[model samples]
Target: MAWRNALTKSMQELRIHLCQTSPASAGVRDFVMANYAEIKKVDPRFPVSLRECAGAEAKLTARYDFGVEKTVSVQGASSAAVLTQLQELIQLGEKMPKSGE
Candidate 1:
């Protein structure tokens, strides 16, 4: 896939923080169910961790090479909105120059 070429060379992991049972987390939960498989299919080796707290704010955190990290809040957004944000983030990461570039 073309997206594979754009994958950040330094991206290390992805962490999803959300409340297991909360209205604000509904969209993220839906997004996960709809896209999690596709995400891993994109890169099985990339670690994606899910941390559920009863009342935690929904957020997406991506850890990149050299400990660089990016995060975005997904609170109350619909699944499509969440997907859009994720795609935008990936595009942004791809545009960022790597070390020694």
Candidate 2:
């Protein structure tokens, strides 16, 4: 919810890919558990997707318009670190206009 305004603009989707039981995904898992609800609450129309697999890498993908996407590896990252990255992406969204804006 740090930059919730981004959700109403060019932030198309927020995808979190992580392994269900991998140690590297622990932080992401914890983050989803604690803050995912709040994130959706901030922007009810924003799309937040979670994908869990046995051996998937832990990553966060923020998709914007014009097929633009920003991805960051969250492998072994702390929940706070993930949140910081997301806030940065939101800030980026504010500056990156959508196609034909």
Candidate 3:
């Protein structure tokens, strides 16, 4: 019972956080979408516009845009490289930082 209550509370907090953060993220999505033409020339598979990107981001979180930006920022790099870097960051997030020497 306690665990279930804790889980419910955690989920509620997450929902609130999402609601607060989503608007800023939506703005970012709009900015990215406005630049889609330039971004698409860099990567053909990029979404067609900002609304699409925002929808995806809403489902996936800001990390999706971070990955896309990281992927596109490098010249002559494949999308796979961006995915690889994102994966590394995700893994790093799962681990604890080392103590000071």
Choose the strongest candidate by lDDT: 2
What local lDDT score does residue 52 receive in model 2, on the 0 to 100 scale?
90
What tens-digit string does per-residue lDDT give for candidate 2 at 17-76?
999999999999998999878877878878899999999999989998877899989999
Model 1: residues with Cα > 4 Å off, grouped in runs: 1-10, 99-101
- In candidate 1, residue 55 scores what lDDT? 95
Candidate 2 to native Cα RMSD, angstroms: 1.7
Instruction: List per-candidate RMSD values in Å.
Output: 2.4, 1.7, 16.4
For candidate 1, lDDT tens digit of each residue in 1-101?
A: 45433443445677889999999999999988987787788778878899999999999887766667899999998888877777666776676666666
Residue pairs with colliding backbones in model 3 are none
The local lDDT score (0 to 100) that residue 1 gets in candidate 2 is 44
Candidate 3 similarity to native, TM-score: 0.24
Q: Give me the displacement of residue 94 in model 1, in angstroms.
A: 0.7
Tell me how candidate 2 scores on lDDT: 0.84
TM-score of 1: 0.83
Residue 12, candidate 1: alpha-carbon lDDT: 65
Candidate 3 local lDDT, 6-25, one digit each (tens): 22222111110111235434
Error of 1 at 42 (Å): 2.6
When 2 and 3 are scored with lDDT, the better candidate is 2
